[model samples]
Target: MSTFPGTAEFYRQFRPGLPGALPTLLDQIAPAASPRRLLDIGTGPGLVVEALLERFDDIVALDSDASMVAVAESALRTPLPHGSRLQLHHGRAEEFTPSAGWQPHLVTFCRVFHWLDQSAVLARLGEYVAPEGVVAVFSDRSLWTAGNPWQRAVRDVVQDFLGTQRRAGNRTFESPGPPHTQVLRDSPFSEVTETVIPVRRTWSADDVIGYLYSTSFAAPYLFGGRRANFEAAVKTVLAHFTTNGVLLENNAFTVLTAHRPSRHGKR
Candidate 1:
């Protein structure tokens, strides 16, 4: 689990929200008459809950990082809008223990599954998730994996300061094994479906810099006394990529929803 002590605020400020139609797609998984309960795992700044607040009446937003959880609490104030109940927990996803008699209708992982012990967490979820429920993993193609020139320039500037190694918190980042789809198939939730939502974003040089700070790879603290210099360098490089003071990119956000086959053997 990663802690975002210095980067939590920037993450809250710059992270992109879910696509507008995502909540509707998630809401359709549960029966219309049933009260929808959501367990949003690794819910940084309560982004998922904020987006799906009206759809799910009960929400438990969990994050391993205390600072991130605190940010979420401040952003999603108590007695949430539309009468939703939002509970914030600071704990690791793999070690999470659900409340007594709690069976959430849907459990979600937003840009966080890669940090978890996927098989172990899924095993634990099987005990508390409703029989007809689903697990949705949401993530987007990161700027780190640049598909365009402007993104590549931002990435190059970041690497020049932070070194070429990908960082996850204090450690060099490594992709988790077996892939998410293969891991899900090996678990109780064998039925899997994927949806890719294409999105367009426009960013100013400042926005790019702020977004860089929001990531584990290039957070300000990682620069030590050179943070200011790093910021200046980033702005200089981004100037070449901007058009009318902004940069644009078409990105793909994907959702992987998985569930156990129904008793009737239907997916």
Candidate 2:
């Protein structure tokens, strides 16, 4: 069975902190109009959902991975003064349908859409988003472009791994992102918009290794036959970069948002 950690472990390297920028990510997506309901598809651990709960009254989230979904569900279920405005479910995006009773005002897939079938995902997403609802595809790019030099070097090593093969979810802490993984262009979203936000996270060397292990493809490669080389590369990366005790990664990515006009369904 495939695990979602391919995505989870990567970001969790920066976890306990990555979600701090939620307010900014939310603003970039234009929650200005007030969403009645929100759905976070592939919501790894509800980082985005926790952000949504602060502004929107109702939220629904789904993740295909059991572990990822568990983390997200636990986050959403945390108690708040006004109570949680969030609902959590575990399932694949293809099997997830808009419940007959509710049409969400927004839909989102963060950092994991590339793993799904775009056309099918969108065709189904269209049904859930109220006519004027918006769909967002967000990624954090700062780690690829920003702070530390060693991080940049380590990134080069990891990408050499990915570019030579198909790697997804390179979630190194303080690590920048690899070049944009080409996503499906003309899918269900009627209109698309994107913005890049500058951000940073603190990380340790071990964090980077775990981050690599969380990749959709990198995990298998490292844990597979190339384990020695992969471990050696990580050692070389850390030895070259470690100064004092911390590594800073400069990365940036566009917060891409696509909208489906509200006139298409329940207003």
Candidate 3:
């Protein structure tokens, strides 16, 4: 789990651009209905919930951490222009059982898919989604291929902190999208779409440092929870501070959406 405080703060930090991965997710959800209800899995801090509520009505956001849930609850309590329909739940998708008649029109997970038991999560998530509702999983690709020296420096520093364990399951910033998305192709989902969304993040040195320490990879294993080590690595890489901002390369995102198979046996 990530030790970063205030989950909502991370979303606020990363949302500006932090790799343009949103389009891929947006495209898969094309022909998006005015989603009446959405189930957001592992809704850390609620950025994705905010994203969904921006496009839909009545969102049910989930996260396992109480603090994260608390932060999300505080961040998402207000209604948007359309209506007040967002609900925050503190729980895991695998252990979450929806009451009868509580199907949702859209289901999603932003960056937290990697932390889940993918098989069990998919099986359980199968229940909450309304018929023909879609399941989209998203992640930023900027971690792998950096467009410029600025981002490359940040990537290197963060990766070094992540160590080999985090890298072993790593996918290139540009590739076939999520591994689980591939693993899921044979069954529950009827179609799988992998698309790239190119975007960029302009980071000052301060923004860069916070983002590095915010990552789950940099949490503790390698740094021993000593943030100075993480900060030192960032300083080492960001040797050149130019006005141009970071011309981050391919600092994009890949989104894989697996449309749930219609009328599953479990359902």
Question: In lDDT terms, which candidate is top?
Answer: 1
**Could you give candidate 1's per-residue lDDT for residues 1-267 as a string of tens digits?**
564558888888898888877888888765442456899999988888888887888778899988899898998885386666778999988899878977887899988998888999999998888888889997987889859898888788888987898887678889779978989989988899898888888988888888888888888888899988998998898888888898998987788889887723322
Rank order (by lDDT, best first): 1, 2, 3
| Model 3 alpha-carbon drift over 4 Å, by segment | 1-11, 14-35, 142-152, 155-178, 220-233, 244-249, 261-267
Q: Which parts of model 2 are misplaced by more than 4 Å?
A: 3-22, 25-35, 79-81, 141-152, 155-164, 167-188, 220-233, 261-267
Instruction: State which candidate has the highest TM-score.
Output: 1
In the predicted model 1, the residue pairs found to clash are none
- lDDT tens per residue, model 3, 1-267: 434443345544544432324634553464354446678888777777666555667667888877778877877776454565777788777799776777766677777776677777777766666767777777774343445766766766666666434432222222334576575685466477776676644566666665544454443334656667777777666757546544333355567777765533222
Instruction: Please give the lDDT score for candidate 3.
Output: 0.61
Task: Return the number of clashes found in candidate 2.
Answer: 24
Local distance difference test values of all predictions, in order: 0.84, 0.63, 0.61
lDDT of 1 at 254: 85
Ranking by TM-score: 1, 3, 2
